[model samples]
Target: MPHPCALDPEQVVEHEYVGLLDPELRERIELWEEELLDAEDASAGPGNYDSYEEYEAAMGGGGPEGDELTYQHDLSIAPGWKVGGFASRHLTDPAPVVCSCGAGMRPLLTVHGREWDSGTLNWVPLEDLDVLRLPGANVPAGVYLGRGLMCVFVCPADPAHPHRLSFQ
Candidate 1:
């Protein structure tokens, strides 16, 4: 369907819309970032440990290695093109994205620069395994939106209502 103001370009106005995030989920994500940062800081240099397993063992084996909390958080919010899914608030804190009609907007589409990154390798489709080994396999499209994702939110109350755009 066409946007509400597709025919009238001037009718579409620019405004800021903040995304909403759960406090508990935000806390968990913060913890995850901290853990990753700690791991990076603890590393002496390349070949500091023979392998990831050795590094984990040296870190007391209590961080993100096979951690349920990390897995759950990562799994809940996926990266890449998607429809009707949770948005990734990796770059900023979440706030509500409200429609002009006063209805809460729902995520309709999300565009990303790449299908998956090092941290999100779990999201890669099994069918793409053969291509995954090739250079630039993760980045099928060269599109880049700063350093994060761009989500388009539509008003559930009325499809004709203008949709909002969010960059996170």
Candidate 2:
């Protein structure tokens, strides 16, 4: 057997990492990508002519209704996913939390979630969102505006994973 302190002759030194990422982080990222790809592939239909970018855009409501969808926050996505929307750190009661970056947090004007397991759909107004925190979301992720509604993006852990806090 080789000596405990001595290195194996064929072992690599592990001196070079592509960046700050360690193997575990890399593995998580890979796994997440794999899940996203699988989910996308399975959901895609022949001659659908829709792309994820288009889907993402539609999900954000940037497109007119009836266009290719980006997937609604209440449909294929989980809760707490951050989406592009108007946000401000300072706010009124129940929320008004401070961001880790020291920016004030805004309220979630709106929210959505799809429970694929139960085939349930959800769409909450701003008043109710003062509580729920979804995954992989930043503080801005939770904040919403305009009739107190915000779009829900899928948790980054996996496109199909359960909702997480959007804002940190």
Candidate 3:
């Protein structure tokens, strides 16, 4: 499926590499990636795609109805980590109602389990399996929000102000 929020083909978006992460955090993220890959692979059953194109064709739906997607407020996953989307899971801690700068906080981005899930079938990196499985085994943060999402909030007064983490 076409990404509902995809921009026009001629639109230009710039992205800069965020500096390399600390060794410890980098290792942790690598481990999480490995876990996610394993889960996705295991969910693909016994069959295997011989090439990336085959997998893409089988998992996505950018066929003839590319423009059929309608914009809605509550989608399952937040595409491109965009802001304004609601948290997928229920909140674990809703604190930080106010930022340290004494200003209201706004959602900065949504940390998703997998880049894509079954509903969207937009771009499943690895067979688009059920990545949102139980939060067992080596969870990324030792915090399990089920298949839920984590919303990061930033201070309106100062972007540098410490951010907050709220799980849904």
Candidate 4:
């Protein structure tokens, strides 16, 4: 079926930054990634921790510090190509993508240029682990949109409503 609204191509404004060079922020991100990987590992195998409390006890008993909201946001949004999931706020703070019809929009599609990066290795499929060392393996599709992702949001109130696009 054809989409209800026509999308016009427009130039996207770019912002400059020093990249993820902040030592403290970088450390937090790295720690979060490690924790994710560890949690995945613990849950995947048999005879591992039976509960979150046990897992926390096994590892040191402390949650993320300094910018807890960002850590929680990262956990809420799944990386890579996804449909019908929470939009990632990696580049910007959480904001609602509202429709002109006064309805809240939800993420309909999220396109990612790379399946996994240095900090998101846990997202890689187990079968693809063998090719981790291969160049371009992480980015099967060479579609790079702005910083890395482009999300499309649609209003639940009406499918015919215009979809909103966000880049991060």
Best by lDDT: 4
Q: Please report, in order, the local distance difference test score of every candidate based on alpha carbons.
A: 0.64, 0.34, 0.46, 0.65
- Scanning candidate 2 in windows of ten residues, the lowest lDDT window is 6-15
Residues 10-103 of candidate 4 have per-residue lDDT tens digits of 2222121223246776676668777876675574456477788776654544243211223433334556666776777778866778999999
Model 4 regions more than 4 Å off: 1-74
lDDT of 2 by residue, 1-168 (tens): 211221112211111122224768667655766676566556554424367677554344323332232222223223332233332211222243344444544333324222111222243324334533453212233334443334333333344443323321
Backbone clashes under 3 angstroms, per model: 4, 21, 3, 0
For candidate 2, the lDDT comes to 0.34
> What is candidate 3's TM-score against the reference?
0.34
TM-score of each: 0.61, 0.21, 0.34, 0.57
Q: Rank by lDDT, descending? A: 4, 1, 3, 2
Q: How far does residue 151 in candidate 4 sit from its true spot (Å)?
A: 0.2
Window of ten residues with lowest summed lDDT in model 4: 9-18
Q: Which residues of candidate 2, in runs, are more than 4 Å off?
A: 1-19, 49-168
Number of clashing residue pairs, candidate 4: 0
lDDT for 38 (candidate 1): 67
